[model samples]
Target chain A: MPIRRLLVANRGEIAVRVLRAARELGIQTVAVHSDADRESLAVKMADMVMPIGPPQAAKSYLNVDALMKAALDSGADAVHPGYGFLSENATFAEKVESAGLIFVGPTPEAIRIMGNKSLARETASKAGVPCVPGSDGVVDSVEQAVESATRIGWPIMIKASAGGGGRGIRVAHDADELRSQMTTAQAEAQAAFGDKSVYLERFIRRARHVEVQVLGDGKNAVHCFERECSLQRRRQKILEEAPSPALSADTRSRLCESAVQLARSVGYRGAGTLEYLYDDVSREFFFIEMNTRIQVEHPITEMITGIDLVREMIRIAGGEPLRFKQSDIVMRGAAIECRINAEDPDRNFMPSPGKVHEVILPGGPGVRVDSMLYPGYTVPPWYDSLLAKLVVHAEDRPTAIARMRRALRELHIEGVKTTRGLHLTLMDDPRFQAAEFDTNALEGWLAARAPAASPTTTTSP
Target chain B: MAHHEVLSPLPGTFYRRPSPDAEVFAKEGAIVKVGDVIGLVEVMKQFSEVQADAAGKIVRFLVENEDAVEPGQPLATIETA
Candidate 1:
């Protein structure tokens, strides 16, 4: 079905991203926001802005009923979850579909399969994708976790069976630590993901986090190479680069093939990311999980492949076939992305929320900044701290690094503390340049270069 | 006697206290001053303190604790005196 009017059931940068894509397709966009985001750039840019509820996401963005009502009231033919919030909520997807409004995502069943990590692991295993050795089902008790750890061996990772974004994960080296971490992990998992079910996996230390972007038309799927997102702190990716430096040509091809196989196994549709942990020393890659929605680091893939993923998602939702064949796809150059957040990385990444007095974005060749910020815009404390994503692409890794550094230096936002300085330092680090790091690299780097005592704290000017 | 307008600045679940069974920040018939913390509204993970911009006596409570509210949703009617 062709989507005429689309209601974006999200806010902030992603709302703007979806709105921009919809506008390009000549679709009217309806933006739903909390009371706090009445003046947000997304609301201002959208064709119509409706108040979903208050600032709380529960009453606003995640309120499936409110979103459906808004879509109905606005005469929107489709609803886009735009990542996070209820983006992966299967019930919400089904409700959207049942309400006669097309959901701009995968099938509700696909969302259900991927939302549960254990089920996804099983699905990947069935599809011949390598997965970490761990429990095949949910571990409901500490005893089960300990037994699983003993069987899978120590240094096991306890993760929420229905978790993502590093929320319900705990790594334990011994039985005692495993027991304690299991409780904490379960509690956090319940609070964050609304699921207390936990599972175990053999922890793969020093693993490079790589993921392939895939698009499917519910029948066939195509892979968009791989992106290295190892530079993360607290399990959140801070930087991402396409055409991972760690992957050999053979490994890259195999990884992409595996991702395609997995996508085909589920008859996946829309934009999805197949995440894997690649061990450099072992040269083995294991499937982690799949994100059944548009990813935050999609810009890097776009920079390298020159494919508008968002546009393609809309097309696929409209029942279009795969736009291009596998042979037609080509990765042109290395692309890097640095997530600029409104936080003081020097001070434990505490959120720095306030008004943006002055805003300056990077430019020049290969530089792309996706943001929803403007002067006098208030960085609301009610949402994610990401202010913008700075992406750059060049002929090679070194050139891409240089471009990213230049972009970081050129980027400026006054009246709010940002992680721009941290990105600059990371781009200049020798280890980062050599690509000899793992997911823990950022945390180690920060620990080694701890900000000076009494670091200067700035507020919105 | 003077008249004052009670307005909600943001939308969220309005709570009269930090938690259930806890004393509310303000009550009906209580004299309130400008800038007084009258209630709390949670949006996402952040909790915002809704302050009274006009001094008056809270004559009527318009919303119950933990009630879902929208921006400009009336919380309490205040009578300036």
Candidate 2:
């Protein structure tokens, strides 16, 4: 089926993003919402609206039964799980497919194989993709972790086997530190992901967080180059840009090809991103894991490659083959995306959720504001803090930076604190301009700027 | 006895316990002091301790566990000496 009707099983800006793509494709859109999102922009723009459940995500968005019922009730032939919630969940994908509705992403097997960190590493290695040297599988005990740490060398990272997005990670430089942190890491992992199993990997110092965007049609896969997402806070990417400044032309080609090889090995379908750790010192990259859905930073890639990734993913889900060859998809101008979050950057990046009294989005050529914000819209605290993404493209990185600075200045969302100031400061940062930072750079920069303070009060801004 | 109502300082989801497996921070009829954590308000994934502003015995919690809350909303009532 060509997806005559689509159900968006998510909220926030991504929901609006999907609605726009569906509208352009002439697909009837159905927006599913919790009680808190009844008056959301997505609901207003959707052709039909369905209330799933209460405000909590568990009773609503994450509830597979509720989502499926909504899909069927709204007459949607396809369901778009827009990043997070159930987007990468293999069971959810299986359920959607078994229910005779199209899931706008990869096959369930691919999601299952790549969702686990240890298993994904094994699969990558089997595909001849370079991966970080680590333990063969999940470390059983603290003694076993210490044993593996010695072989993997000191400064190993204890990562949750079933975790992603930097959750349940602990780094130890020596045996004593490893022994002490091992149980804590396991407990944290179990608490966060419902899995206590963890794996050890050699922690790469001064490594840039690079990921290649790949699209597949179950048989053929092509890379859309790479994105430099090194500027992150606590493992969360705050800013991202396509065509990494760290990679040379030769290295970039090899890195992108390895990502495609890994995707092909898994028989991936739709759009996905292969995350890698790029060591600037050795000029080598290692595949860490693969996100089997449209990433939040997909827009920057779209800007540079002229490929609407969300649209392409939906088309692929609708049984369409790859539209362009590797050579046809060319990276043109440099593009950068600044994540405009509802956070107080100066006050330790505390979450700032409130009603928006005013909204001033930037315009003109090369500037795009992808957001769900509107005047009188109250940002509920039940979801992620991301309010908008200010994306800008230019001829080169420097010009892109300048354009981003201009756009950031023009963006003014009143009533709630945002990361606008932080991004503006980054635009002027020499190290950021020179692209001389890694995954840990943003945290260090933030800590230096404002020393540790007491825990944030529950006072709303 | 004087009665005092503890209001939620911020809006979000309110949880009586620190973690899912943990017990409630302060049960009803439990004696609480000023600045004692009675619950937690999670706003956009960041948790902030909901502290009682006055020393008293908690009469009852107005909302159930994991209920949505708003700023200045009464969460619990305390019977003070």
Candidate 3:
């Protein structure tokens, strides 16, 4: 049956995104919000609003029972979990399905298999996808870890079996450090992810973050090329650009093929991203993880391909078979996205949640702003710091970069300090202008900009 | 009497108890010791216990049972033991 009404089980710009997609598809939307979000833009845009619970996410968004009750009460037949806060939760998906409502994403089993990083790596390897050389599974002990490190080479990454968003990870340069850090890493992983199992991988230096966006129909999948997301702050992506300047034509094709193969192997559905750590020295890429939901940086892909990813996900959830084949999908031009967060970059990227007194979103040719910001809007401190996503598209990478720079200047926000100034500095930096930086670039850049110029990271990469 | 503030570590909602069905961790006028959990802060569905780093007598709570809170927001006051 076609979805009559959809319940958006999220907040922020993503919530607004889902509401717009549903409206385009001629489906009604029900917005569920905690008390803190009563005046949010999503609540205003929604056809109907329901109180999920109190301000706390546990009693609100993350509470499966509360979400179900809200969906049922609002007469919604489906739930769109917009990235984060139970978006990739397997048990939540199962519960939604058992409640006789459509879960707008991949199958629960697929999520389960790929949610565990070690299991996903093994599955990717079995599907003939290239993975970073490391332990077969979670290392049994420090002795086993040492042996594996010797075989895998030096500079290793210890990762938790069930970690995401850049948590539960430690990097060691030698066996002595690995042995000393093993207990600490395991304890951290256990505390953070509730899973102590840790695995090791050959940590590649001078790495670029490349990921392929794939849409699957449970039988096959198609790739929409790749996005270079190497510019990150504290391991969290802050900016992304499509058609990476680093990839050769041959490497790009191989990357897409590998991503599609892995997605098909799991009978994936809806939109998913296969992330990789690209070695700049060897030009080899290894599987990192798979995000089984729409990513925050998806607009850059959409800008170049003209494919509405949110609409595609809604259609797939509605049981429509993905019609486009590998040949049919085309990627043109270059797109870049800057995540404008409500953070004071000068103060260690501290969250700056307050009332948005004034707003001026850049609008011109090749510029688009996906935001939930409005004058007099109070950014609640109960969730992520992301306030908006500024995206720009042009015929090529250089033009895209120039357009983004222009948009960053045109954009204006008041009342709360933001990363806008930081982005401005990055856009003007000679190194960033050449795109000659890796995943660790932002940290080095920030350190140099610091008044003290901490000795920990002096030379800005 | 001088009171010590028990500030929440992160933003979310302040809970006076572990769960909805449980009793409040500490009551007004109750004696509390260092490292004692006075309340809970719920953020991203993760509950962080608000421990009394300084021993004190439980003063009146400042926030309600499920009021929204931000980082460093005072959840309650603790009088010197």
Task: Identify the candidate with maximal lDDT.
Answer: 2
Q: In candidate 3, residue A367 scores what lDDT?
A: 97
State how far residue A37 of model 3 sits from its true place (Å): 0.8
TM-score of chain B of each: 0.88, 0.98, 0.92
lDDT of 2 by residue, A1-461 (tens): 69899999999999999999999999999999999999899999999999999988999999999999999888889999999999999999999999999999999999999998999999999999999989888998989989988998979999999887777788999999999999999998888889999999999988999999999999999999999999987678999998899999999999999999999998899999999999999998999999999999999999999999999999999999999899998999899999999999877777988899999999988999999999999999898899999999999999999999999989989999999999999999999999999898988888778776433243433
TM-score of each: 0.83, 0.94, 0.88
| Model with the higher DockQ, candidate 2 or 3 | 2
Per-prediction interface RMSD? Answer: 7.0, 3.1, 11.2
Rank candidates by TM-score, best first.
Answer: 2, 3, 1
Which candidate wins on DockQ?
2
Tell me the lDDT of model 2 at A56.
Answer: 88
DockQ of each: 0.11, 0.55, 0.18
**Residue pairs with backbone atoms closer than 3 Å in model 2 (clashes):** none
Cα deviation of A200, candidate 3, in Å:
1.3
Model 1 steric clash total: 5
lDDT of each: 0.87, 0.92, 0.88
Error of 1 at A435 (Å): 1.1
| Better structure of 1 and 2 per lDDT | 2
Per-residue lDDT of model 3, residues A35-139, tens digit only: 989999999999999998877677898999899899888888899999998899999999889989999999999999989999999999999999999999899
Candidate 1 per-residue lDDT over residues A302-405, each given as its tens digit: 98998999999998998888898999899998999999998778666666778899999999999998899999998876777899999999999999999888
